[model samples]
Target: MPHAIKLYVRYVDAINRRIGRVVMYMIFAMMGILLYSSITKTFFLPSLWTLETAQFFMVGYFILGGAYSLQLGAHVRMDLLYGSWRDSTKAWVDLFTVLFLIFYLCILLYGGYSSTEYAIQYGERSYSSWRPYMAPIKIIMCIGIFLMLLQAIAEFFKDIAKLRGSEL
Candidate 1:
């Protein structure tokens, strides 16, 4: 609960909040695209871009929304043991659990870089006829993971604050 840590947490929180809010709006766009694609395929010419574009946007929806979901405590957890714990104990449990998230993110970021790099260098595309560049989706995934890592770090600090009887 030093000023610096609080500021860092706020910064990360703000980034996640802004990205999450913006990305959530894309769901409407996705819906419209899907509807348009359905109508087109059924009645008129089949649009090659619609389904693939929808997939990209759907990935954006889930990946970009991760930190927001964490903020809202929307991620599913088996809470039978967690629910009974006291605040400090709960904080301890959370601290431990977030380590796993951190590890996963680190691995994803490291391993994902090669695919992203390949996409960027070669302009990688899907095997589908549309052949949309794959980098954007992969890049978005990395960005989402980075955001989630930031949010997880903030949450870890919050847990520490709870353990120490300090407000963060």
Candidate 2:
């Protein structure tokens, strides 16, 4: 069971890393497109959809990459108090935080699942002119939450190992 859990954690970590890389590429692509659009607009005529497309990509990149950020511990933190704690105390605090995150992610996963299901059932489309299938994007929210949940679980066990004075 422990081996299986480890394998699952590794798989989630791999997926998170891959998604993070994709998000980086998407960001660069969006920047390039934005710059090109600005140049074209300044010199000749601007493309009608370039700015709008860039906005869409930005939204997708942020939403999809949320889990990757969480996994990498890159998310913002107000750790002034936490930063002063001893190693053992910090480990316990981290364990508690991971448990809290897991609980939150579980709720998000449930809500996102229902939202995605409803969107799919109704064939919901975005309000934008492009009218992209919003369901897929909504579904990505569920996936992100699930990934976060997995990472939280992993962190919980890692903290437990730390509390036991053992390296994970």
Query: Evaluated with lDDT, which candidate comes out highest?
Result: 1
lDDT, residue 126, model 1:
96
Q: Cα lDDT for residue 72, model 1?
A: 73
* lDDT (tens digit, per residue) of candidate 2 on 66-126: 7688777788877888778898998888888887888888888889899999999999987
For model 1, give the 10-residue run with minimal summed lDDT: 81-90
> Which parts of model 2 have CA positions greater than 4 angstroms off?
43-48
In the range 95-116, model 1's lDDT, one tens digit per residue, is 9999999898889888788889
Q: Model 2 compared with the native: what TM-score?
A: 0.82
TM of each candidate vs. truth: 0.95, 0.82
RMSD of each: 1.1, 2.4
